[model samples]
Target: MTIYILLLLIAMQLIGVYFFQNLEDRFYENFRDNLEKQAGILQEVIKDKMTPGTESEKQRKAIDDILNKLPLDKKNTIQIVDQESVVIATTSGENSRIGQKNKSPRVSRVLQGIESPSVEVSHKAGNRYMVYSYPIKNDGDIIGAVYIEAPMQEMYDTIRTVSKILIKITAAAMVGTSLLGIILARTITNPVKEITEQATVMAEGDFNRKVTVKSDDEIGKLASAFNHLAQHLRDALSQNEEEKGRLQSVLANMSDGVIATDRKGKVIVSNRRARKMLGKDIELNEDINQVLPLANPISFPLTEERESFLELNRDEDETLILKLTFTPVLRASREAVGLILVLQDVTEEEKLDRQRKEFVANVSHELRTPLTTIKSYLEALDEGGAMEEPELASRFLRVTRQEAERMTRLIHDLLQLSKLDSEKVRFHKQPLRLEELLEDAADRFSFQCRQKDIAFSLSIRKPLPRVYADRDQIDRVLDNLLSNAVKYTPEGQSVSLSAHRRSDGYVEVVVSDKGIGIPKKDLDRIFERFYRVDKARSRSMGGTGLGLAIAREIVQAHGGTIRMDSRYGEGTTVRFTLPPCEPEVNPA
Candidate 1:
């Protein structure tokens, strides 16, 4: 509106000024021209009356006659001066002024004949006038002069009136322009204002409010774009939240440790699993070396195709064998921006590999012992010892046979273990009464126990749940347990075989011996093939060291669990469990 007013005011002012100037100029020019024409008429009338012989009074009479006949207003006056520089006649008709000499510079200029028929204008103290001077001539000789003076007050008054009217017109134009400007301003600004307000709401995370479009103009398009942008931002934020949730879930539940780091090797993201694997109080931006020193040697933007492994021996009696993979985050230009480290715990796998190698070595050593002994005895017999001394031949032959039998047993146990490990031995699962198996095993071991003077006992709880197991496999399990008990128990000590129904629908069997118990450290590995606590004693007792291993394998094949618990110098208990059989339903 202000701009409109300014433009209107400026245009109106220029037009008013030009009109006023043109009008004022035309009015002054026309006024002067009319007054000069009147002066010319007076010169003609006065010149015609003037003759070389004509009297001054006659000239004065002629000028006064012309002046009286002239249509002059009150602001206009005329004077006639003779060649003598004297006022001869006046339009005022004053008797004192008719014959007096006019000493005015204009009249003197006319009487001297230096200049003629001149118009001059003057203004002072709000009074304005123009003067016209003409010479009266007879036969081209100046005889007298005529002068007319007219006030410009009426012309100035007309100009002032017109100027007042133009000012009013300009004011009206300004008012109209201001009102139109207001309308235009609202039309353009209203939609913009609404969009700004709604955009502010959207910025505050509210996308409900929509800006109203008033026109199909730029502002309306902006409003439409704003609405779309609001919705897009909302959707993008929602998707971001969903992806964030999924990522968090993966990080929290995954067994592997995930750590994301920046290009500077500063930790950026550390998931819950990573923190738990590292430390619960682990902080972000901690150096990668602090969290995983193995990464320090491998620079970002990995140069190798394969990742490396790290064996972290924790100080808290925990060992972590981690396989580490370093992946570089890249931009569109393939520039390295950061790194992601995936740490997979390989502790169990490494432990199993180590155990397998140790088992192979132990098997070789245990097998070589009996074979080497048998070979020595056979060589002694083949070297004529049997021919030279029959007694020596018998002893050597017996020792060799014993060793051969031990080897046979060891080979059988090895093959059994291999089949169990390969899952090639199928178990025929059926119901086997726990009490019956217990009684049968007790009777079989009773003679051995009596010969050694060791008290043997069987405690099978009545109405025990029938075990779900392979009948032959369970029998071997029971026989192995009782044999171990009898073999390990010293004379005068007691060995008890027991069975009961567990609350969890399983049958628990236990064989306990008051014998030279295994050390606490070796209890966990007592069932391992070729593992022994008293190697020499076991060999002397004709124990192959594979009994417990074979028994465990059979029990496991039958879908049961076996474990051993022992206290050094006190006793050892081997326990196993089998799922109970479903009760038989009788048909009516």
Candidate 2:
């Protein structure tokens, strides 16, 4: 397009210059011809008026009369010279050469009997003059010469005016031509511009868009081609959508969560797994704030140089963990138009991973002690020192038995935990009196409490509500709490077990001890399997550290909850609740 415009401008300039130059030459020629004719006529009048015997005054009067009668056109300057090559008369009221001689070669030649017609001479006035030298002839002899001089300033002036007019016309014509070219260029380039814009939109992945077909010219034909391409692209996109639907179906049925959002951080689609993880049927077009309230806020650092992750806590009241990843969806223009959120439920996976690591470390540690003892005992025996070290051997065997028992207990607890985790353990549910249960559990620990010189007390609110739970699991729960209380309490300190009906119609049992209370930091994690606040003390007291974890699991299985409250160096209280079940009314 630019090339076309440039060529048009160049052609217009050339034509304008040619026309101006031609007009200038023609104007000069016409003016020069008119001046030559006027000079010739003046010379004829002068020659006719002159006679060989004519007196000077009469001749001068005739010359004045003729000159006066001649037209005084603005551009003509007339002068007359006599046969003496001297000034004779001038229409401008002075001798033709008052201060100079008539030095024109044409005048001298005409005086010598050569009848010179009108001729052109360059003058000092910056214009050419046409001089007509006519010989004044008498009876068969040349007498004098009549010279007529007419300056060509009028012709030059006419040519200048015509040249200026022509230049102005040429300039106007060029300007008009340029304007027309601009209009034509717009007519052709506008459609091309529209096509370029449409193509850009398609490149941005908007296949549904098409250009407007406004004409039947080449530009219109290009638009039609672009629209056809858009149609094909739309069909391809439809096919891709079908494939995506199938893929989404597969993802929905899987255990992992799947979530996707648009550029505005609005939830566009989600699978069943995600819905389950969020514990609700999340709808499309919902903002992320409403869909996943517990998830971390989205940070749209599109211009940042780093990627980010969000740890979404779906169930703050339960054990649900969602790991969400944000990835930018870049278009062909390298712009971030949307983001994809991938959610994964890693709760159980993380738990199992922690368990695996702990298991390995625990097994290695558990085996090391026994192996060391066995190695030492066998080494002593191998030195043939059995006779002298029989008593030492007996003590070594006892120590070996204790280590083996510890390993067996650890394995048994691991197996129990596995069963509980897999839901393979059977639970027999029945209604039991809370007071009776607490009494039985306390009785079993009474002797141990006395052995440690610790006071054991039980506080029961009368008419306590009966709880629906597994009897054995509840018994284990009570046993663990009481044992923990006894273990942590100092000798002569008090351990209190209390049962009461909560306002929410649940049976709450609180076992508190004034012992070397757990540290504030360790209170939350005290129920984790193999997590002991005082590891040395727990091991010295023959604890496997799985009792509290098992207790929490069993209580949770019965739809109950357990929590601990403690202040370092003061006391610790372990509280648990079980929902009350309706009592069986006797027949009236």
- Among all candidates shown, the one with the greatest TM-score: 1
Output the lDDT of residue 279, model 1: 50
- Candidate 1, residues 474-585, lDDT tens digits: the string is 8888888888888787889999989887767678899999988889778867887777888898878888778898998887776679999888878889999987677534
Local lDDT at 77 for model 2: 53
Q: How does candidate 2 fare on TM-score?
A: 0.47
Candidate 2 structure lDDT: 0.75
lDDT of 2 by residue, 171-248 (tens): 787678777777766666777787788888888988776678777888789889988988998899999999998887
The candidate scoring highest on lDDT is 1
Ten-residue stretch with the least lDDT total in model 2: 301-310
List candidate 1 segments past 4 Å from native: 1-75, 78-103, 106-126, 132-146, 197-206, 295-306, 312-316, 374-401, 534-545, 584-588
Candidates in order have lDDT scores of 0.80, 0.75
